[model samples]
Target chain A: MKYRRSGRLVDMTNYFLSHPHQQIPLTYFSEAYKSAKSSISEDLAIIKEVFEVRNVGTLETAAGASGGVTFIPRVDIYATGNLIDQLCERLEDPERLLPGGYIYMMDVIGDPLLTQDLGRIFASRFRSAKVDAVMTMATKGIPLAYAVAAHLNVPVSIVRHEHRITEGSIVSINYVSGSKKRIQTMSLARRSLKPNSNVLIIDDFMKAGGTIRGMMDLVQEFQSNVAGVGVLTESIHEEEKLVNEYVSLTKLTEMNVKSREIKVERGNLFDDVYQI
Target chain B: MKYRRSGRLVDMTNYFLSHPHQQIPLTYFSEAYKSAKSSISEDLAIIKEVFEVRNVGTLETAAGASGGVTFIPRVDIYATGNLIDQLCERLEDPERLLPGGYIYMMDVIGDPLLTQDLGRIFASRFRSAKVDAVMTMATKGIPLAYAVAAHLNVPVSIVRHEHRITEGSIVSINYVSGSKKRIQTMSLARRSLKPNSNVLIIDDFMKAGGTIRGMMDLVQEFQSNVAGVGVLTESIHEEEKLVNEYVSLTKLTEMNVKSREIKVERGNLFDDVYQI
Candidate 1:
């Protein structure tokens, strides 16, 4: 069957978007479309042009018998800035202030579009990092972890506080809650991570980084390495943080429970130059 | 600057894929690309043809002043069947069998690609339903819920067993665990769902449908309606199910803890005719 250029372009674009970070040989498309290799190359040229021009992502091509093209998903600096600013505005709502200075953010975390945009930002930041899996604590961080995992084309490994019978064998760790100073336990299934794999830890919110520290420790238990850390929001009011190196999208600057006042600022995502 | 047909096609395809279920006016593309409406119409014709032939989605055109095109994502029957068969094969592994006949499904649920496929299947099934939000219990059900919510362009509302101060005002419900006959508590934030909203419930697995029943009751507590229910796997060995109406992808027919044997089959997803 002979496929037209228009059809191939549409199909190829969809293929690249869905299979981000995957390298596809030109011969694969050539055989599937029953077209010449030259024709497939021209089609990829058009796709690469559009992807770059629109800031959709980057298409890196390799020239060799064992080479192909890879689609690296990225969110451009302008889009990332706009998204973070919007998140800051949303987080500044006084109604989100709880009684104990805790900000209610389930709605923010639950917004699929928002989380997807945030995920793309994180994916762009860590596009060059080797991530075998995206890890997060259960309950709240699952969505953000899955969001980043989807963009990076990796599986998500969830850490849970309470052990479940269906998890088979688990590796449990006890850590101090950074702010409350209360001891908490976090566990991961034994089969969740492979040894020596590079895992990216993600969460919705962080204060003193206790949960993220616990996750980092859990990753070490699996003999895995922490490739990078990304958080949706982090509290700057904490006297000290347990974990130091991480990327956060938004920062909680202030929260007054008595006055029901809350303040938010853009996180340190763009403090350093990043290349995709 | 005027854009070429190739660029317009690539941009339009990406837009439709990203903004599923959203109606885009022909003039919107025409204006963005600096092309005539006739040219934009031709582009849409090509996109619609490719989308249908590829089973990517359906592009419905409305003929009126408010007329435009809406992209409804779909997976063809062959692809759906192949995915389900793969899932069944994966589930039949004896190593997944845990104590008390429970199958360890963290890997399956943690799989981003698998959950996205299952989410697409559920989204296709519930394409025509009026789903205001996708609801599910936290921990296991979150990934599936986010997957469906992303495809449906809706937000997700997570239900949790324990309440946190970060959730603000919450509504709690007590229900009997269908298999264990023990009362359990589930809570949802008051802001999660609006009154009279239609919520689509999704989960990873179901034995007696107790968790789903609890979710349904929780939805009622907020004065909302259950738009639909979807489960990745359901246990057919159960004597009775608490919920009757649900679409399941795979069925666990038998399990033997002593023998470490398990049996799985395709669920009733294809038993009924569906229209995209």
Candidate 2:
């Protein structure tokens, strides 16, 4: 179908956004819109400028027969900081404090827009980690991991508490459930990851980091390397730490079950040598 | 930061893609880009044309001081069919079959790019659903639910098998676990959704449709409506389906455990009044 120039731009923009990290030849758009190659190039030029100025991403164009444009996503430091601050304020609500010094954050986990921002923050922090894929324990972390993988254009590998027939051959590992302090089993499909691949670990919350450690061990079992670790929120109140070299978007400093009070601060994401 | 015309177009496009269904005033773009309102309007015109031609979505622009732009996501029927066909091919892999006629589909569920397509397909089918939220059972279905929610620009509600301290007060429901024919429990946080909501339910796979029915029942408990039900794939071999008024992207027609073969076909999505 033939399209007007205005419609073409909108469609092309969405296409680039959804297919980030992909190289699409100019001719593809030209033929799709039934436009000249020159017009497509001009459209891409505008997109490239807007993306760079807004920190939405970078657009790299190759010239010649195989010439194409690739969109690379980036996060604005100002926007990232604003998102973190808003999340901190949201978490500090008294009602979010549960009995036994725990905080209820499932609402945030179930929010797609919030998860999208959190994922972008993680992806930005680990942009140089060369992460081939994202791995996470099942349940709350799946959305976050999927978000990060979406931004990074990678697959998400989920480790389940139990095995299911749909996963085919599996690799199971025994790990200490951080909060419970009990040995629990985590399993991943044998075909989920290739040996020697670089994996990034993501989780919604980290208490003692035992679970993260277990995941690292599981990665080793796959002959994969843990290139980086990211947690949406980490409890800094723990007197001991079992994991390191990880980044977080927020920190839970204190939670009083009886008083229904909670203290939340920015996570280690801001401490890095990141551009603001 | 002030930007050039091209820069503004790219940034504007990204903004619209990320914040669909929400309106942003033309002045906002003009001020950010340091461009005239007319220039901004012209840019939007180009975007509108591209979006409509590609069927990426619809771009609605309102005039007057309070008027702005809104991005409404859409799915091209041709693209949707191609995606379903590709997924069907992937699902038919001999390795995806297991004993007892169960099909292993974790790889497809775990893929973010493909899930994005699946989500768009769901979003397109239910565009008129007025979906207030997307709901799904925990584990494999969370990603699909989250993706659908992303397209709809809404929050996702995850029903879980077990309770976590971080979820606060929850409403628990009992239902048959579908394929297993055993009684199982599902729970959701009370505040995850508001009353009288129009919820779109998404699942990774369906067998007897018992779980979907259970979810519809649960929605009633919250005084909410089941706007629609969508499954990534459904099993056609099931002797009976306990649920109706649902759409699926693909169907598992047959699974041969002995021969290690699987037959997959287009699902209920195409059965609807969809345009090609």
After superposing candidate 1 on the true structure, give the runs of residues whose Cα lies further than 4 Å from its correct spot: none
Off by over 4 Å in 2: A1-12, A23-45, A60-69, B1-5, B30-39, B61-68
Candidate 1 lands at a TM-score of 0.98
lDDT to native, each model = 0.88, 0.83
Estimate the overall C-alpha local distance difference test score of candidate 2.
0.83
Residues A201-251, candidate 2, lDDT per residue (tens digit)? 999989889889999999999999998999999996455678968888899
Give candidate 1's error at residue B81 in angstroms. Answer: 0.6
- Counting clashing residue pairs in each candidate, in order, gives 0, 16
For model 2, the DockQ equals: 0.63
The best candidate by DockQ is 1
TM-score of candidate 2 to 2 decimals: 0.93
